[model samples]
Structures are given as C-alpha cells and as structure tokens.
Target: MKMSKAAVLQEYQKPLQICEFPLNEELQPGEALARVEMAGICGTDVHLWKGELPIPVPVILGHESAGRIAKLGAGLERDWTGQALQEGDRVVWASSIVCGECYYCRIKRTPTRCLKRKAYGISYCSNEAPHLRGGYAEWILLRAGTSIFKLPDNLPFESIVGAGCALNTALHGVERIGLEMGDTVVIQGAGPVGLAALAVAIESGAAKTVVVGGPAHRLQMALEFGADAVVSLEEFPTAAVRLEEVRRHTGEFGADVVLECVGHPSAVPEGFELCRDGGKYLVLGQYANAGNVEFNPHVITKKQLTVMGSWAFEPRHVLGAIQFLARPRWRELFAKQVTHRFSLDQASEALDTVRRLEAGKAVILP
Candidate 1:
C-alpha cells in the first residue's frame, strides 16, 4: 500500500479531516496515476457539505481537478508514452463514467443520464479501490473508462481548474438554449456558472446580455466579461419587482432567453418571468433536495415559452469547454474568478467560504 494525504468528509455538515490513507499500487490495465495539482471548489461541494445534497460520507470530495500524469498502468504505457503525456504531463479529467450499455447511451440521448453513472468525487464503482477515486488528494488513481485530456502547454493550471466543471455546464446549457445572433439574454445569478453562461451567451452573438443577482464582485466580473447590464437582487424584495427592473433595462417586452444559474427554488419562478413571449428559459443550476416553487401555467401556454433543464455535461460539452478556455482572454477571466485558494488540508474551510459566498470561486491546491 502506498500512502497518500487526503481530505475526507466524516459527517454531514461537519469539517473534513486531513488524514493519511492507504492506496493500492496495483493499477488495472489502461489505468493511470495522477498527482493532483489543483482542484476547484464548486457550489455543489458546498451543498454536499451542508447536507443540502446527499453524497456518501467519509468520501474525499473534489470534482473540478487538473493534475499531472505520474504513472501509467501496464498496457497503457506504450500508447501514452510519447503522445503528449509523460511522467509529469499536465491533464484534466471528465468528471464522470457512464455505462455504455445503458438505454440512454444506446439511443445517444444524453449519456450523462445513464443509470449506472459514477461521478469521480461523489459516486464510486465497486471495482474501484477507495483511494483510486476523488480529487482532494495528493495522488489519484484513474480507473479504466475515465476520459483524461492533456492540458495545453501554455494554459495555466489555475485557469483550467477554475474552468473545469462550470464551463462544461455553461456549454451544455447554451447548447440547450440555442442562443442566436442579436438575441437578448439575461443570466440569473453572478456565480461562476452564471458568469460562464453570460460569457458564452455574449460569444454566441447575443446583442444584449444582462446578469442579475450578486455579491458585487461577481456582478463586476459579469460586466467585465461583456454583460451589458448587471443588477443586484438585494435591491428588489419581490420577483415581480426584479422582473420589472430587468424589463426596464431590457426592452419593454423582456429577454429572448433567460438562464437560471441560481439553484435556489425562489429563482425558478422569477426566471420564467424574465423570458419574453416565445422565449426560452434554461435552468442550469443544480437544485438541492426536493425544493418546490410555484409558477403560472398560463405563462407557459400563453407565451409559448420553452422551459429547459440541463444537468452535467456530455463529452462534447467537455471538449467545447476546453476549447473556450483555449482563448487568450480566458487567462484574465480565470484570474478574476478565482479569488480564494486553500491547501487540501483546509478543505472544510474552503467549502465554508464558498457556502458563505465569500468568493467568486475557491480552489484547493493539493
């Protein structure tokens, strides 16, 4: 057994413990070992820590990770040897493994929705040894069937880590929304995913892009990233008031597309109102346990509005996210989004910081 340092969650709504754990050295053919360099703390991680989402405890938590390929399993050595990968080559991995035989996979109807899906930091397959999974660790053992991509030589590790999970979600949401040139778009929430959606909307040629919701810094970042207008939700106590304010800034009608990046149930009804007649509403945020909201059915039927939902991204979205980050301007965006960085030992503190909305995005460097 090889020893590795990891931050393990011991209980719900509790601090994570930084402990030494035993890892299996025997890797299955096609597997690889990655020495983790950086892992971004996502809002979902905060949800899990707060017991808002049910992820198994005693688990090492981290999904947005980038690292270096340290060692390759037996048969993988030859294929990976000189192909942009080496003992210290930088890399980032797709977050989950899907069962290829599942019905969704067979029909090509969202493979990420496969019943046998296993997430790196959340769910573990039975065949995987405990230490072979998760990113909040000194070393992670990549199992077979995992999709690993080499990072561009010029890309900063923090940039890739910051863009990891959020960008993929943004890409998927934008694909679902199908934004067109000269379309008016409003993104709810100014967090990482919201800001990402805003960026993609602007890149998609949206004539006017508005970002609503805030903590000041995120709204500022949205403006920097090309948002035509930014609004702080704290000013409006009611959804109708917020919608009125949004309409005043936008045309008298409303936005052509509304993207909800705030997972709070309260935002769902407001998001629907932000979309104009014959517009689309995209829900990109992952809501916690059974939250309910009230919405007028007449608004959907009368306006001919399309309500869409997007979960984790597919492989194509992952590739698109990587390409989006390939642009030179992404360096500035990454630097702006990541406001806090903590060692793996301070995982709980980092998570708390995110929960309290203390930063735009917090990262954990192992």
Candidate 2:
C-alpha cells in the first residue's frame, strides 16, 4: 500500500502532528481521489482547534479545498450537474454527505440539516479506513455520491480558495432571505463570510451596503468588494458607536436588512439593534456552539423584525458560488483576498495566522 502525508489533530488546542498513512489507492464503486492543490483554513477550522466545535479526535482538519482528479471509480461519468468528468480535471467537492432519508432532507427539503450528515474533513476520523479524507493531506478520497464540480481552464485556484466555503455559505443565506433590488444592507464583521455577504448583496442589487467590522484591512477589502460605506470596529470601538454609524447611514430608519456575519455571541444583540422596524436580520455566523448570550425577546416583538438563522450550505449553493466567482467583476477581487499561503507542513501556522486575523484568507498548498 502507498502512504500519503497528513497533519493529524491528536488532541484539542495542540499543533497538528505530521504523520504518514496508507492510501486507499484503488477507488471503490463511486469514489474519486483528488490530489489537493490548495486547501483553505476557514474560521471554523480555527474554532475547531480552539475546541469550540465538538468533533472526534485523530482527525485531519480542513474542508475548503480544490484539486485535480487523480482517478475515478466505476459508473461515475459526469459531474454533479451532468458535466463530463475525466482524470486530471481540476475540481472542488462538496464538504458534506447527507443521508437522504432524514426528516430535514426528505420533508423540510433542507439537506444541510440532515440528521445523519458526515462532513469530509470534520467528521471523518483519521483512524478509520480511507484515511485520506481531509484536504490537509496530499490526497482526499471522494466517497460515493459526492457532488464534484470541474473547474474551467481559465479559473484560477486562488479565486476558489479566496472565497472557500464562505461564498457557498453566503449564497445559501442570501437565497434564504431573498435579496431585492435597491435594498439597503448592513453587514456585520468584515471577515470572509461578511465580505462574501457584501458581494452577494451588491450582486443582488442592493442600493447601499454598510459594512461593520475590522482591523482596517478587511474593511478596506469590503469597500473594494463594493460596500457603499464602512464602519470600522477599531474606529468605533463599541457596538453603540457602530450602531450609531449604521443608523446614520440608514437615516435613523435602521437598514432594510442587517446580516450578522461575525460568529461572536456579543454581535447577536447588537445586530438586532441595527435592523429597522419590519426589517430582516439574517444570522449567517454562529455555526458552531461558541456558547450563548442573553438577549431580551422584547426586541423582536417591539421592532417587528424577522430573525432568520442559516446553517451550512448545500451542494447547489456551492455550484452557484462557482458561477458567481466566474464573473469578471468578482474573479480578480476575490483572488486578492487570499493574502497568505503555507505548505501542508505549516498547517499549524496557517491556523494561527487566521486566528490572529493577520491574513486575508490563509491557504495550504500541498
């Protein structure tokens, strides 16, 4: 058996241990092995390292990835949307595999909330079979029924890595809320998710978009990504000040929509304060259990605000994200968001850079 290199998380809050594992060179009935070109270190990955999200130990930690197909299994002929697939085609795969029979999948039609969903990098244990499950390794095994999308020749890997799961997640949330033309949007936290939400809001024909978040660099990128006005967390220094700035931009009516893209618990209550009467508040962050915050229910009733929470994305959202990135306006700017790249051996360093908010979008190039 051939061996592949992987960075294993043996314990929580510790650096990944580099090790070699036997590769399942031969594909099963519908499996495909992709040689990882670049894997992104998402904010969720940082949360996992901090033990914010519960998971099985001895796992290879990475989910946002892109690569070339090394091989394919029998009976697999086309991509997820019916495009032809072949060896050496550049591709990106959906992160999770959902059980189609679950209530959320069958009845609610929300496959992302399927009861028995198994995510590629997060759920797969390195101690199990087909050990090359995560993108932090040289190769990842695409199990049966995984939705894979072939990349066009002109599409750069940096664009996909720059957006990563953030774009897909934003696509899902925006679709849920239904962006209308000339809508005024206020987006909180200028991280990848926030910036991606800004991009979506602009494309959805938002008349004015106010971005709140920062360390200066991200807010600058938000402007470049088409935010009409920006409120810096560093400049404001408090939620009250930030809310005042947003109100100023919205002419004291608040905003048509306020999106909480920052995963911090404190951002939740403040997000409610930014929404106008009868406005919609979309919470795209708080995906992991980052603890809880106490907030009064009276705010919801008093403001007549619609509160909606979006979870992780589905495969169609990933496909839509690719199409959105393929646009000329987004391709170049999105690529620039990937400011840092490290080799697979430096996975620990990549996570640290993201945790410190020092890098735009950190990627691991194997």
Candidate 3:
C-alpha cells in the first residue's frame, strides 16, 4: 500500500477533510498510476459539497485533474514500459467510464447514459475502493478503461486542468448546436462554462456575440473575449426584459444561437426567449434543485426553435478541447480566464472561492 494525502468529503454541507489514505501499490492490467500536479474545483463539486447534488459520501471529490504518469502496471509495462513519463509530463483524463454492454452503448446512441456509467469524482465502481478514486489528492490511481492522453509540451497545466470538464462540455454543446460561420450568438452567464462557450463561439466564426451575467469583471472578460455586447443581469428582474434588451442589441429579433450556461432554472426561460426563429438553444449547465421555469409551448411551435441539452462530454470532445487549448491564441484567452490558484490543502477555501464567484477559475495545485 502507498500512503497519499487526499481531500475527503466525509459529510455534506460540511468542510472537506484533508486526510492520509492508502492506495493500491500494484496496478492491474490496463491501469496506470499518476502523481497529480493540479486539479480544478468545479461548480459541480460545490453542489456535491452543499448537498444540493447527490453523490456517494465519505468519498474523495474532484474530476478536473491534470497530472503525469508515475508508474505502469505489469503486462502493460512492456509496451508502455520505461516510457520516461517524468515528474512533470503534463496530462489530463476523461471523466466518465461507460459500460460497452449497455443498451445505449450497444446502439452507440448515448454512451454517456450507459446503465453502468461511473464518473471519476461522482460515482464509484465496485472495483475502486472508496479511497482509491477521486482527484483531490497527491496520487491518483487510474482504473482500467480510463482514457488518458499526453499533454502537448507547449500547453500550460493551468490551461488544461478544467478543460477536461468545463471546456469539454462547451465543445460538446458547440458541436450539438452546429455553429455556422457568421452566425450571431448570445451566451448566458460568464462563469467558466459560459466563458468557454463564448470562446468557442468566437473561434467558430460568430459574426456577433453577447454575454449576459453579473459582476463587472466577468462582463469585462466577456468583452475582452470578443463579445460584441454584454448585459449585467444583476440589475435585471425578468428573462423577458433581458431578452428584449438582447434583441435591441442584436437585430430586434434575437440571436441565431443562444447558450444557457448559467444552469439556473430561470435562465432556461430567458434563453428560449433570446433565440431567434429557427435558431438553436443549447443548455450546458447542471441545475439540480432549481425550481421549474414555466414556458409557453406556442413559443417553440411558432418559432420552430431547436432546443437541446448537453451534459459532460464524449471522449472525442475531450480530445478536441485539448487541441483547441493548444492554439497560439489560447494564451490570450487563458490570461483572462484563469484568475486564481490554491493548494490542495485549501480545498474548502477553493470551493468557497468558486461558490462566491470571486474568481474566473480556481485550481488546486498538489
């Protein structure tokens, strides 16, 4: 057994504990070991800690992770043996593991919905002992079937830590929405997910883009990222008014595409109203306990709007997001998006920082 320090979630609505735990020394076939260099605290982690989102307790909590391969297991070593994955080879991992035998996987429809799906920080497979999984730790044991990819040498660790989660989600949504060149887009919320969607929209050749959210700095960052206009929802009362304002800024009808990244139930109704006739609305946020938003069916019937929902991401999107991060212009985007960093020991504080919306994206470095 190898001893490692990890942040454990012993109870909901309580501070996470930094405790030492035992990890299996031997890696099974197809499994690999990594020494975590950095892990970003995501909004979902906050929901899990607040008890708003249901997750198995007494579990280690983290998914947005980046690290280096430390050791390779038996049979796998010969092919990947002596691969010289040094102390800092920089890498990121995909979050979910799907059961290939399930109905969804069999049909290749939605592999993410496989009956035996297990996420890194959310669900635990029987094979993984309680302490062996999760990313808020110094050492993490990657199970068999986990998709691991080498990080490009030129990319910064901070630029890709949360890319596996947030950026991948954005990429998935963008793909589903099928963004067209010269299309007008409106992004709701300036949080990590919203910001990511905005960046991808611009990179996809959006002719005009608008971002709606609160706090001056977040809006400022939206403008810096090529948003033609920004709306501070802190002063707005209803989605109708917000949509009206967005229409005035765009052509008086609405945007060709609307991305609801806020996850709040209210944003759903607002997003629907902001989408132009025949346009698409992509919901990328996760709203667990949020109350329902009332919308008229006539809106969709009359406008012929195409509404879609996107969750985490498939492996393909993860790969594309990593490649997107490797672009030369990525440095400028990172300069504004990554605003804070914390140590793994300060996991609770890091969660609080993201909860209060005090930073663009906060990462915990181990």
Candidate 4:
C-alpha cells in the first residue's frame, strides 16, 4: 500500500498540519492519479491563509501544479488535447471543474462562472473521498472533466511552474479586453499575475508596455519580461508619482489599456487615472475580494473607460498558456521568474515566503 504526505490547512492564520494517508491505488472510471512533482504557491493561497478568501477548512492548499500521470483510469486514455496519456507522462491540470448544468455554464456559456464550481485545493475539503485532490500533497487525483495537458519534453518544469495559473489568468484577462496590436498597455503591480499580464501584452503586439510596481526585484523582472519602462514604488513612493511617470510614457494622453493586477482595491483609482479616455481597463488581480475602497464613479463615466473584470480562468485559457510557454521567447523570461523551492513539509514556509514577497514564485517539490 502506498502512502502520501500532504499539508492540510485546518485553520486560517495558522501553520499547516502535515499528515500521511493511504493512497487510493484504484482509479475510478475516468479518474487519474498524478504524482505531484512541483506545486506553485500563489497569492490566493496567501489570501486564503489570512482568511481573506473564505473556503471550507481542512483543505489541502495548492492549485498551480504539474506532475506525471501515475494511474490512468479505465476510460481516460488521452489528454485534454486528445493526445494519448500514459503512465509517467508529464502534465498539468486545470484548477476548476464546473457543473455543466449550472445557469452560468449552460445559459451564459461562461463555465468559469458555474455556480456549483469546485476548484482543486480551494473547494475540496480533505475529508472528502480521493483525499489527495490538491498539489500540496504528494499526489493529486484528477476527477472526470478535469482537463490535463501533456507537457512537451523540451519545456522545462520551471516554465509551467513559473507562471502557473497566473499565466492562464492573464490569458483570460487579455481575452476579455481584446487587447490588440500596437496598443499601449500599462500593467500595475509586478507580482506573478502582473508579470504574466505584461508578457502576454507584449506578445500580443503592444507597441509599449509600462509596469508600475515595486520593491526592486519584481520591477527588474518586469523589465526582463519585456516591459518598455518600469516604475518602482521605491523610487516613486506614491501613487501620484507613479501616475506621472506612466502618463509620461503615454504622452499627453494616457495608456490605451491599463491592467489592474495589484489586487488592492485602492489601486483601482490609480489604474483608472493611468488609462486614456475611452481606453480599456481590465481588472485581472482582484479575483479575491480582499477588501473595499472608496473611488469616485465619475471617473468611469468621465473617462469613458471600458471596464472588464476577469474571474478564474477556463481550461481553454490553460491550453492557451501552455502554447504560450512553448514559445522560446516567453519561456526564457518565465523561467527567470521561478525563484524558490521547498519540500512538501516546508509548505508553510513556502507560503510565508510568498506572503512576505520574498520570492518571485515559490514551488513545493513533493
């Protein structure tokens, strides 16, 4: 009998309790078991730890991951893209599984908004059957409908684990705003999601991309990821100063698009101010309701800015991200973003590193 180790979050704002449990060796009809090789800790996990994002307790916390197929069930013989799946094939799976019967899934055709959606690590409680549903564990059980993509041999694990879901999240945001060629884009925040947005914007043929965020390392990464200019909060120190620099790049007018990837409610007003009148503003980072801010609604009307908020990403977006990473140009920059790693037992430490902004991306090797 095989046993698996996992870090279970029993309480918010506390250390994760490590536990060992028996693995479910038998795969049900369409299910598969993956031996988790690397699992990336995301900003959402930090929010979940602080009790900012409400979720069921006693969950294994990790969603951004890639692994090798350990056991393929009776029915699922191929990957999501229809490639044959065999034991030991490197792969990455989509985080959320939607109920096709939901109104959002069926009527609106926006399955990402499925009312009964269950996400791995976020929605699944460890008490449930097939207990290893999250990447923080040594194994993850892929349920039916979960789209898995086989990784190409040349693509390094750092490329997939580097951007993780942030790439797909950025992909969905760019898709929502319909960013076009030669557009000027200003990306606010230099975290994983922000960096991902910058890379995607540049790849989409934006003439110029300016990144506003801080400390020093993240801003440097923004430059490496192909930002035309970067505004470090260490230098600007205030929203007003940062806005001035961003406006300078946009000339007399503001940026054609402003991506709010900071997730702070207060950043919305700043991002709005950086956008040109009639420009587009895509809120990609506020996937979690961290808090609220008092902003003048008049700005939205006066600027005539097209506002769009992207939630979690769909499987297609993940497919798009994988394709994006396969490109050598993007992979080089993304591979630079992977800055730290820890063992499964060091899950809490990894989360702490991310919470403190100590690393670009932290992954757990189980």
Candidate 5:
C-alpha cells in the first residue's frame, strides 16, 4: 500500500498534524479515487477547528474540493448526470450524503434537513480505512453513492473552488425565500456566503441590492460582485446604524427580502429590521449551533414577515451552483474569489486566514 499525506486534527484548537495513511489503490465496487486539485478553507472549518461544532477527531479537514478522477471503481462507468466517466476527468463531488429513507428526505421533501447525513471532510475520520476521505489531502475517496459531478471542459477549476460550498449554500437559502424579480434585497455579512448571496440576488433580478457587513476588502468584492450599495461594518459599527443605511439605500420601506449570512445569532434581529412589511427573510449562515439571541417575536407579527431558514445545500443546489458559475461572466468574477492558497501542510494557517477574514476565499492546492 502506498501512503497519502493528510493534515489531521488530533486535538481541538491545536494545529493540524501532518500524517500519512495507506492509500487504497484499488477502489471498491462503487468507489472512485480523485487526485485532489484544490480544497477550500470555509468559515465552518474554522468553527470545527475551534471545537465550536461537534466533529470526529483524527479527521482530515476540508469539504469544498475540485479535482480530477484518478480512477473509478471496476465496472462503474457513469457520473451522476449519466455522463460517461473516464480516468483523469475533472470533477467535484457533493460534500454530504443523506439517507433517502429519513423523514426529512421522504416526507418533508427537504433532504437538507436530513438527520442522518454524513459529510466529507467534516464527519469522515482519518483513523479509518480509506483515510483520504477529506479534501485537505492529496487524494479523496468517493465512496459508493457519492454524488460525483463531471465538470465541463470549459469551466475552470478556480471558479468551482472559489464559489465552493458557499455558492451552493447561498443557492439553497435564496431558493427557500423565493426571491422575486425586481425585489429589493438586503444581505447581511460580506464573507463568502454573503458575497455568493449577492451574486444570486443579482442573477435572480433583484432591483436593488444592499450588502451589509464588511472589513473593507470583502465589501469591495461585494461591490465588484455587483452589489448596488455596501455598508461597511467598520463605518456603520452598530446594528442600528447599519439598518439605517440599508433603509437609506432602499426606500422608506426597508427591503423586499433580507438574507442573514453572518453566521451569528445576533444577526437575526437585524435581519428582521431590514425586511419590509410582508417581506421575506432567509437565514442560511447559522450552520453551527452558535447559541441563541433574544429577538422580539412581535417584530415578526407587526411586520407580517415571511421568515424561513435553509440549513445547507442539497445535491441539486450543488449542481446548480456549478452551472451558475460556469456562465461566462460569473466564471470570471467568482474565480477571482480564491485570493489565497496554501499547501496541504499549511492547513492550520489556511484555517486561521479564514478565521481572521484575511482572504477572499482561501484554497489548499495539493
């Protein structure tokens, strides 16, 4: 057996250790091995490293990855879209696998709410066999039933990895709120998720878009991504002032829709304030259990708001995001989102960069 080097998280809040595990040269009946190209360091990865989210230890961290097919399982010849698969084809796989028989999957018709979901790079353990299950490694093992997507020859890898899961997640939230054409949208946060939400709002025909939350560079990217106006967190500095700016950019009536992508519980109340009467609010950034905040329910009642939340992206959303990024204009801008790159051994530094909001989108090139 050959060994694959992986940066493993042996303990919480400590630097990831570079370790070697035996590589499975021969895949199982329905498995495929991908030679990892790039792995994106998401904000959730920072939360996982700080032990803020529950995850298996001794794990290879990274979920957003785009790579080429190293090899396919014996007799498995087609991708999820029924595309013929061959060795060395570029691909991107869905991060989570859901049980189809679950209540959320079968009854609720929302597999994103599936309780028994296992995600690559987050749940998979490096201590186990086929340890190269995560993206922060030279290789990723796509097990049986993994939703493998073959990339079009024209779509650049940078576009896929730069948007990464953020685009997929924003797609989920945007769809849930049912953004109307010509709707005025106020998006909270200026990180990858918020930026992606801004892109979606513009693509969805939002008449006016305001992006709130920033640290200068990210706000600039939001503007470049086609935001009508941006409210800098450093300038506004408070929820009251930020809400005032949003109303100013919009009309006397706030916005038709508000998206909370800040990943903080405190963002919820402000999200309500930003929405117009009968407006919609979609929260997608509370991906982790980041406690609760006190919000007045009377606000929802008085505003007659339609508030909803989308937990994470489904396989379809992942495919949609990829196709969206493949467009000529989007392909160029979203690809530029990958501002920082790191080697696999520098996973800890990559995590810190995301934690400190220093990169547009940090990716690991193995």
Candidate 6:
C-alpha cells in the first residue's frame, strides 16, 4: 500500500501535472523498484516538451536518474555488470527496452536502432501498469528487460546524474567514430553532451580540445572539464566569427575531429567548415529533427570528410559511462556541472531551466 508521487507530462507545451500511484509491495519476477534520489533533466526532455519528438503524453519524464534499490524481484538478483543487487544498493538503469526480435535487433545486431524500443520516460504512458516508470517520481520501477547497474558506494548521485544521458550518448558517438591518441578535437556545443564529449575526448588522449558554444557558465565548465580553448558564442556572436576563433585554436587546417552537439541542423554547415579536409565530422546532437538546413553536399566531396552520425546509446555504453565516471576526478568534475536542483513538483521549471540553457545541469531531487 505504498503510494508515490510523480510529475506527469499531460500535454506538450503545458505544465507537468503532479500525479500519484500505488506500488505493489511484491514485485513481479525480473523487476526491481528504486527510491529515486536525483533525476537529471535532459535536453531530450526539453525537446519532448516542445512537441519536437513524438512521445506518448501523460508520461513521466526523467530518463537519467540514480537511486537506492528498494525491492528486487524473484529472479532479479544482480546488476548489469553481474554485481549482486541488494535492497540498499545504489543503482542506475537503462532508459529503454528493445524488442529482441526486431530487424535492427536481430538481423543487424544493433539494438540501439530498434524501432520498437520503448524508453522509460519518453515512451511509457503514465497510466500504464507499474505506473511510476520515470525518475520524476518518488520511485521508478525497473521493468523486466531493462539493464539495471549497481553503482559503487563512493560515486555520488549528483555525479552520475550530472551528465545524465549525455555521457553515454557521447560515449556511443565516440565509439561510433573512433578517437585517436593525440588527435585535436573541436566540440561545437557547450551543452551537457558537448561537455561530456570534451571529457571523453580528453580521456581518450586527444592532444588538444577546443569548445565552441556558450553563454558564459557553460564555457567555463568546458574549461574546467579540460578544454584547451573555448569559443564564446556571445563574444563571437556569429557562426563566421566562431569558425575563425575555432581555427585559431586548431591552427591552419582546423581540428582533426569536429563534434556537432548543438542539436540544430543550422550547425551542420559550421561543423563541415570546422574539420580538417580529410578528418571526421560527427553529428550526435540532432536527436530530434529541428528543421532543414542548406549545407552544401559539395563540401563532403571536396573535404573528403568521414561524415558520421550516432543516433542514441546502447546499454553497454551505460556500463562504459559508469566505469569512466568511477574515476574520482571525473566524478567530481561532472558533479560540479550540476547548477540547479528542484523538487518533483517543480519539473516544469526544471525543464524551462534546461530549455533556456540557464544551467550547466538541472535535476529533480524527488
């Protein structure tokens, strides 16, 4: 007879309605429940709110969260990494569950592209069974097929949720287009994904990194996360000027790798211009189709660029992110990116903070 409260998105471009649900004292086989500690507001959530992505309404909206295990089902005894799961163990779980029989899942063996995949916060309806399916709630029910991983005791909730899905999304993108030792990287957005990509690139042994994006705080965080140079959009104020600033840090030929983490199609042309002729251009930030852009296809041929796009992350990337963040310095750096916190009822405000790009990171302490 345990009741939990959650912030449900009743409609797009509308305030999230606070709702309550009852949790079963006994969990079904292969399921687990966690008491949500912190749920990070992701850029994707903001996109969903704007009706950019078609998500089921009356849905609870928080994909990146960490919590203490409350109850383990009959057969669910271990985390994704095979660690034993106890009631009090700290954990984070995958956002989506894929259908194993899909063409993308079975034939291609690429589950990330599974068209039938259902994400916790994005896909599930609030009225569905095990109603507390998102982290914007007091509790999140880790469904049967979801990969739940137990976090180490030393890792704080803020650090794991700080980067939110950005870390794993960046991880997948990096893996999709490999980063080399001593390569120069230019990250074209100072958002969470860009910052996480910067960290990942530096960790992967990039000789230099330049970040382009900003108000002021996000650029500062990029520096803290270890960027060699930062191009302030405010200072540059134009794509042409920012391109020049990026080239200054990267030298005459521009960076070896340029990451488009700006989530807008308009940034695509700049990404092309920011890469060295034969280098790579990675597009990972356009999760939702913002609009059309008029980038020249001739540049792809002229530059001989290895153009790549990473859609979303796989569960293994989550494990990779956890292992990467386990480092004390990394954990601390990411945790520092958390600039705003709100209660579950303030979910709309949290989304607004992210929408305006006001915080390095915003979270709901449900």
TM-score of 1: 0.95
How close is every model to the real structure, measured as TM-score? 0.95, 0.99, 0.93, 0.98, 0.98, 0.98
lDDT of 3 at 11: 84
lDDT of 3: 0.79
Per-prediction tally of clashes: 0, 0, 0, 0, 0, 0
- At residue 115, candidate 1 shows an lDDT of 88
TM-score for model 5?
Answer: 0.98
Descending-TM-score candidate ranking: 2, 4, 5, 6, 1, 3
lDDT of 6 by residue, 268-335 (tens): 89889999999999998999868788988999999999999998888899999989998888999999
lDDT of 3 at 191: 84
Q: What is the lDDT of residue 175 in candidate 6?
A: 89
Candidate 2 lDDT for residue 263: 94
lDDT string for model 3 (1-366, tens) is: 668888888888788889887777777877778888888888888887888767777777888887888876655432122333343456677877888888888886788778888887777522346365788888888877777767777887777874437788898889887999999999999888888898899999999999999777888888877789998887665777787788888888899999988978878877888988998989888645655778888888788999998877887777787779878676457634767778878998988988898988888887
lDDT of 2 by residue, 203-258 (tens): 99999999999989999999899888999888899888888988888878899998
- Clash pairs for candidate 1: none
Off by over 4 Å in 2: none
Runs in model 3 deviating more than 4 A are 75-88, 125-130, 162-164, 287-289
- Candidate 4 error regions (>4 Å): none
**Higher-TM-score candidate of 3 and 5:** 5
lDDT value, candidate 2, whole model: 0.91
lDDT of 4 by residue, 1-366 (tens): 888999999999999999877798788888999999999999999888888887988899999999999989899999889999999999999999998898999999999889999999899888877788888999998898889999989888889989899999999989889888999999999999999999899888999999998769998888888899998888998888888888888786889999999878888988899999999999889878789898898999999989999998999988898899889988877877889989998999999999999899999999
